[model samples]
Target: MTIQSDRARDALLDAAEELFARNGIDAVSNRRIVEHAGAANHSAIAYHFGGREGLLRALVERHHDEMARRRRELTEQLGETPNIHELVTTRLRPLIELLDSLPKPSWRAQFMSQISAVPSAVEVAKEVIGDADLPDDLRFINGAVDGIPEGVLRGRAYLLGSMVVGVCADQEAKMNEDANKGSWEQVGRFLIDAAAGMLGAPVTDPDGAVRYPSVPLL
Candidate 1:
């Protein structure tokens, strides 16, 4: 792509992210995105990204490489057998650091949080990031946690994703109002500690007999 084309593509991504975060993925229209991007062509989204889904995939993939690299560095620093806290930190700190590195009032976190509830968008992200199945890090964490039933661990994993997205969204929103609401590092520590506790919490039913109504949980 030419320099002008790259700029237009980035503009579209930025406009889509902010609009999706502010309104919603379903509420935002292609025309609005094009207008927000200041593109002359109404079909700029289609021309650049194929469609909304493709645009969503592009947005998710934008920062994936940096986030993956950060995670890899953190993982390498861990000892042979890291504890739950260390594992949780390794899993989450990279994302928090990424957000921290962004300019104030960034929509990336809020955009991701909104996308997390959309099954199709989540699938797109999973496709790009390759975490649809049991990732090796998650499997390692599961093994490290003693006596936790597989079902419960899976459930906790779902909750962990929800919690991280929700909290990060809230934090990002607050940064818009007061940039000093709290440091990203502080938020990262809190999330890491909370995740460790939640994941390491004892399960009362080891047999996995506890049943609850299956609703769309996360």
Candidate 2:
């Protein structure tokens, strides 16, 4: 694409991210995005990204690329073998670093948090992560965590991922409100410690698991 085209695409992505993050994906319209982007054409989103879903995927890819780049660098610094803590840090630090790097308060963390809650958007995210560019580092980390059973590990992964998003969103919202109480590094450390514990926690109910009380009929 030409320089002008690239700029237009970026404008659309920026506008869409902000609107979606603030108002919600369903609340925002294509027309609003075009207006916010200052694009002359109403179909610019379509022209550039095919549609809203495509635009969301593009947004995710753009952010994931930066996160993946940071992971690659950390992995390189760790050389061949890194401990489980270090591996988990590699998983999270990049995202926290990105949040720290952004100028002014941003809605990006909340945007992602919202996207993660949506079923369709979750599929988009899965597709993006499945094709993540940080190959060796992720593979190495996966191997390090291989002790956990696959099903249990997946549940843990979901919990960790959700926790990260929820915490970051709260921080971002507080920052926007000028009510942030803690440092990013402090939060990162706490989350890393929590994630490490959750990942390493032993199974207590291996057989049939613990069942909850059944609901009574009205």
Q: List lDDT for all candidates, in order.
A: 0.81, 0.74
Query: Model 1, 1-218: lDDT tens per residue?
Result: 99999999999999999999998888899999999989999989889999888898898888888877887899899998889899888889989989999886689889988886577876777777775434466577887888877677667777777788899899999898795558989999999999999989999876664343221112
Alpha-carbon runs more than 4 Å astray in model 1: 132-134, 207-218
Clashing pairs in 1: none
Candidate 2 lDDT by residue in tens digits, 103-182: 66687887887885566776777676663333333355557664554445455666677788889988988988889778
Clash pairs, model 2 backbone: none
lDDT score of model 1?
A: 0.81
